[model samples]
Target: MTVVYKLNVFKDPEQLNQNVFAAQYAVRGPLAVRAEELRAQLKEKPDSLPFTEIINANIGNPHQMGQIPLTFIRQVLALCQYPALIENAEITQKLFPSDAIARAKELLEETGGIGAYSSSQGVPLVRRDVARFIEERDGFPSDPNHIFLTTGATQAVRMMINLLIARPYHGILLPIPQYPLYTASMALYGGRTVPYYLNEETNWSVSVEELQRAYDAGTAEGTEIRAVVFINPGNPTGSCLNEKAIEDILGFAKRNGVIVIADEVYQANVYDLPFVSFKKVLSRLQTENPNDAWDKVSLISIHSVSKGQLGECGQRGGYMEVTNIPEAAFKQIYKLASIDVCPPVAGQFIVDILVRPPKLGDPSHDLYHKQIKDVHEQLFKQCRQLHSALSSMKYVKCQEPRGAMYLHPRIFFPKKLIETAKAQGAEPDELYCMELLESTGICILPGSGFGQKENEFHIRTTFLAQGEEYLKHYVAGHNKIMEKYE
Candidate 1:
């Protein structure tokens, strides 16, 4: 008998794809592509590219979007790239401290070169520097060994999530309007997402009651509630957590017997109140609870160079600090990271720079201070302008950004809006965002893909677009959309 074969193009559309991950990862629709094509086209005719401006609202890349890297950072980073930079008179303009210079030279001498692969965990001296940075940040001692540098916080998150999955039934709990990195990692790893609602009415905070309700519901179903993830100075919604809220969450995790996951990439970017860490809460809770309950809660905090004053998105450097972890779990988590060999060596340098900035009296102090001040001020103003602009929209209700760079406002749209979008064969927010894309060349992430409530709608856009022109254009474009919503 003769057998006949059919091509995949002839198969059922869904059947042609393998793995649920390939589909879940597909959640980010076409914005990235459109942004790239626009840039490529602009590169072809540098002068005639309408308005000398093509804003990339897709990712938070400050440098690519015209936010210059800190002088000290780029100076040191340049040295790392081409060691000849050290001897170059023009480049050595007090960007490195005596200690920092000694440290970098020692690192280069020890490693022979930046091109060499670091230890699976990262360079020892670099990890030690990170631990020091954390200790200073939280006012608690940090162990160097617990630090695992990854390509960025993204890899570290995946590793932490890998350790949490107790099979399909168990889940990781996160705020609904979370960074999609959380959802994407969970879906790709065969884990479930347990979403709790963020109080948009209260500037996207975590209420103790909300935490209890979600945890109780999940555990009541015998769902292996593995971890609770919170983005301090949140991602899409830029509200910083209050002290009581942090204490309540620490207590909640302590009582519920779940891991506490913190994404503190924007830790240094707080505007109003001082930024607090779960480690700070954990330390405080230890004084009262005394049972070491908070310590025993199995915690991992993720940090990135991609946010705050560093905002090194292209560097893609981040570290996950594993604290009070069980020995077996720690080994397993590190082993998962080892499978990737190690994060990029150059990125490891970025982590070192973040953790070990110039202290007082160092050679680079004056310049470092000036550089940090200027860049940080620019970011602060941008956040203010964007927040003010969005708050002016009658149909957009946004919280004032306390930290980070995005505003996620719930947009008022008609009941038939989603249905109308379905008629167009698209997600409602996606349809809304795409119209914004096609008409004005503005790009942003719709809230639906980032895990918003069932009937709610919103969009996330960064404030890094240069000059008044793009932001003014953004605000005006949204006004047109809001008129439709009205």
Candidate 2:
């Protein structure tokens, strides 16, 4: 008699954690994956698609879209990675600048080496530097103890969500059409997402009334609203919140006894308006209303090296500054970080460079400043050009994004197109985007992936890709689809 073997338990999707399976990240979701497949096919066949190459307008990855890395950052990182280079003084001195070498030596002593594990919080010196940077930016004192160097802002947000969502019914107020990371994290941690819609017609402004209404609805349903997330110079919407908006949000959080998680990774990407930090606004409130317990309002402000002029997405450097969190809670948060052992040491090195860059008259100063300026001007120019193209399309309406790398445009699908999408069990925007990718070899995300009002459609695309030729193809393909649907 032959023995029979059981199949692997994890072979069945049901056997795994459903939360992991249920979470959706549309930025690198199905459409982006398909784009990769098409890219491979084109590599082999060379004539597989109508267009010659795939233009990845899907995600805000600048370097992948042809952004040049800054010289100082790379040079310092190189020295740190291999101290042998520094030891070979004459050769290294000629190749690397004096300051970069000195900076690398300083960081190497603090970090031990790139391969070693840093403090679970981060390297003490780097954390202190980050604190100093925050103090200067916000005009408020920052505690190094409260600063946690993360893999990126993504990890920082995840840590906060994990700490706050203690129960299944605990909830967080998230903006509709948010960066999917927020929603995905909430789902992973098993919490309710109370969505507050932004006013798209009014430049995607935040209304305090909507926040109150969402909070009330969640509370009514027995959800303990733990925190509210604000993405200034927002991800998909690209709307920058004014000082008044920041003040109103802080007041709402203070009154409701909820935490404020501000995602300000795009702080350096502002074009139309000045980028203001939540920490600054909160400090001002505390100073003005000394007796009003503004100190009780807790906040976690996050920033990253991935989105700015640095564009070091692969390097994975970021920090979170926590204010007014209780001692007990802060300790628990530290423990959570310790469990991960530490973030990437190389990433920590990047964070150090990010906070303290070359100054005036430094050997690398002029080149670094010029590169930064060029990137900023190029990105702003690209944003304006893309916005004009989308606005000129037949049924597309786009708001000029104030900051951030992406643009979200509302698309009016014809009745027939909507009915066709329904028949296919897909959102109209999703269907349109898929067709667009196949025809144009240009990948962009659908608005449905980022949440939208009922019966309306939109799409999110990054203006990171360079050149005008691909844009012409995009416009032509878009109008062709509209004409066909009409």
Candidate 3:
């Protein structure tokens, strides 16, 4: 009496799209999954592991660890979520700050309330704010039409990849140990990934020679290199690109007719070096060489609220600023955005505040300034502590973190450890990270996940986890693993 379903749909991995199956995102790949399993187990059995809690140093997530949200941002978001709060004078006066109420009212009026869907491109007023912000930062004019508000920098990256990769043989040049998102998107869009290794000894700096080599190699292999992705204040390496380096990259793109996709999400996270936007540099070049072909360069620069001092990862707000994009191509990008209807209404609201926070005379100025300064100082302090700790470990060479929230240190594993990893069909760094996680509950990503040179071993750990006590635990766990191998 029972009907049998014939060949259950998508039951087998093979039933799914081959491209999806081939794509591997190592940041949240296996170790993160295992950490979650351990977390669940700890809830059931407190004594099941050596540590009481799982320390997630695997990703650059600030709030999940303990970073507090900015007071002004949350206040405005609260009012936006419930407009009735604005009508209640008692609640508004007691609970909300005057600046928060004013901002919420303005944004609510502009977007017609957070419940409604914004324009496919984004709220017009928000785009204007973004344009003004760009003008202030780069000292160059920006058009509201060229800006596309996105769920996050991740979505913008996917759209850019989709736009550039018209054929299966088209390739994108990505830095080795690059953010996995770039590689993952290229995979998803059926594009080739050509890797250009950063010079690790020189603070993981980019080399023009390496870029040319990568490009030439790809061309030799009959792959048309269409775009180059640069993650400034890089994700795993924590290195910031100087103005000169950015200029060189733009010149390369100009000469090769390749599209430049600059990921500047960590613009505010720079420590030792000043942050420079590719757009700013590009503008300078275009202005200087009025007769040259600088205007022919197509560039897409992206920024986000996730990694900056704002630390609004869950908000999922970001924007892509396009320059020299053809009118036809711009229409295609717009069409793609239209397919998604619009980004999150709340996210668009956050983007507005991100680009245009309180001014010097505003009511929330002092508190806002103090909160942002504290976040910056704390991040810098933690970066130094972790870098110092890792630098002292045996056979480990750690780079001083210049920007971003991670320290990717190279670990020289012993032959025995390598053999053990080979026996288990894993990379040496993967084995080390797994054992460290099992023994100490400190989850970090292996360098293999981010792509390293042959015979080189490394691990990427975020310094976002608070306190020196966990740092001591990490050092002890790491040394124990090394001693066992030795």
Candidate 4:
């Protein structure tokens, strides 16, 4: 029996002009969705099944992998969700470290309760706290009015792109081995992505010559480059930036009339060495370009509490600050942001607590520092351990994950394995990774999922395997499978 489907919707006027998101396809990767189905089936199977382990490194949800959340952020969240907790002494103490308590009490006094909605832009106090955090980090005074709180940094990123993309020819400059969020968002928003290559030989750091080459070619191709997105302490590639590279990029932005989009979400995850913030780098560079104020070049930075010590991936708390953006440009941005109503109130409360917390000797201070210190050291240590282990393996080349949790190891694809994978009709990287998954029950993302050099095969796995047990599972599973292919 033949089942036929009609394709007549395209003839309708509403359908012809309607759906832009349908054309965007990368989000629906077979490996990701199929993993979900496989998991459901595996869940019902017994432990004595053929699969040796199930280590999920496919997504970057640290908490899902058994990471503990910071007490301060979640405490306030509980209080926000259920106001009765405000009267509970133990609950109130945990909810706020110290300054948060006073601020929350003040807000309650002024508003009577948090049950009502906040201003369309965001809570003024929370935005002010975000501004203060940025100011102290960069040593430059930031205006609270310019801060726009969002559910997560992703929303802020899309909103900013909407303002920049006025016409079809509009383009954004992104790094080659870039975060999919940027490219995916650009596709959905009807903008072009001009990719610049990072120096893979130099541990995936950006080089001035490379940026110059990309910018020149993009402009020559008649694509109006409105912004350059820099993921400091880069995602997936896990490379930290040096001061010189930061300055070079800033200078390029100033010269090119391109806005700088700094995705500093992993700012606090530096392992062996410290990660520098774009705000700090730009503050110093602005001194060099002394004459230019906001017009020299505009900079917008996106940060998330979902990362760093807060690691509250589910809470979705973050802020985006516009630095040196003109009043007119900001007007357009504010108008669009206002339409979102406001970021989640509970998430806003968490961000407020994160950006501004209690000092030492404050009631919650000891607990806050105690829990945070342990979590930071443990996570950072894990990053170092996995990188060291993977680096020592044969045919696997990996740089130390100085910032983010991901470890991307370049694989040595054997000819036989490549031929087999090709015959299997799967992307070479996908074929290699899937075999590893089924053989070991360990799921990981292929480098091709994120952008990597062509003909290159790599895999990215998180260090967040549920402590030592799964860590041992990861090492044994990967080593065993990879040895067979070799």
What's the distance in Å from true for residue 41, model 3?
1.7
lDDT of 2 by residue, 228-335 (tens): 999998989999999999999998999999999999999999997999999999998898889999999999999998988999999888999999998999999999
User: In model 4, which regions exceed 4 Å deviation?
Assistant: 1-28, 88-104, 107-115, 292-295, 483-486
Task: After superposing candidate 1 on the true structure, give the runs of residues whose Cα lies further than 4 Å from its correct spot.
Answer: 1-28, 41-52, 84-101, 415-419, 484-486
Candidate 4 lDDT, tens digit per residue, 359-388?
Answer: 776676878888878878887777777777
In TM-score terms, candidate 3 sits at 0.98
- Candidate 1's TM-score reads 0.90
What lDDT does model 4 reach?
0.75
| Candidate 4 to native Cα RMSD, angstroms | 3.9
Runs in model 3 deviating more than 4 A are 1-4
Q: What is the total number of backbone clashes in candidate 2?
A: 0
| Per-residue alpha-carbon lDDT of candidate 1 for residues 1-486, written as tens digits (9 for 90 to 100) | 899977766466666434243534322558767656766776887665443545667667788778777766776666777777567646554554455556567678756778888888888888999999888887888899999998888898888787778598879898988888888777777777888988898888889799889988887887788899999989878889977888888878888888899898888888887899887777667766776656787678888888877778777788988888988878888788889888887788878878887778877777777877887788888878877887876677887788887888888776666778889887788877876775567778788877788778888888877666666777777777656755
Cα misplacement distance, residue 274 of candidate 1 (Å): 1.0
**Residue 256 displacement (Å), model 3:** 0.6
Clashes of 4: 0
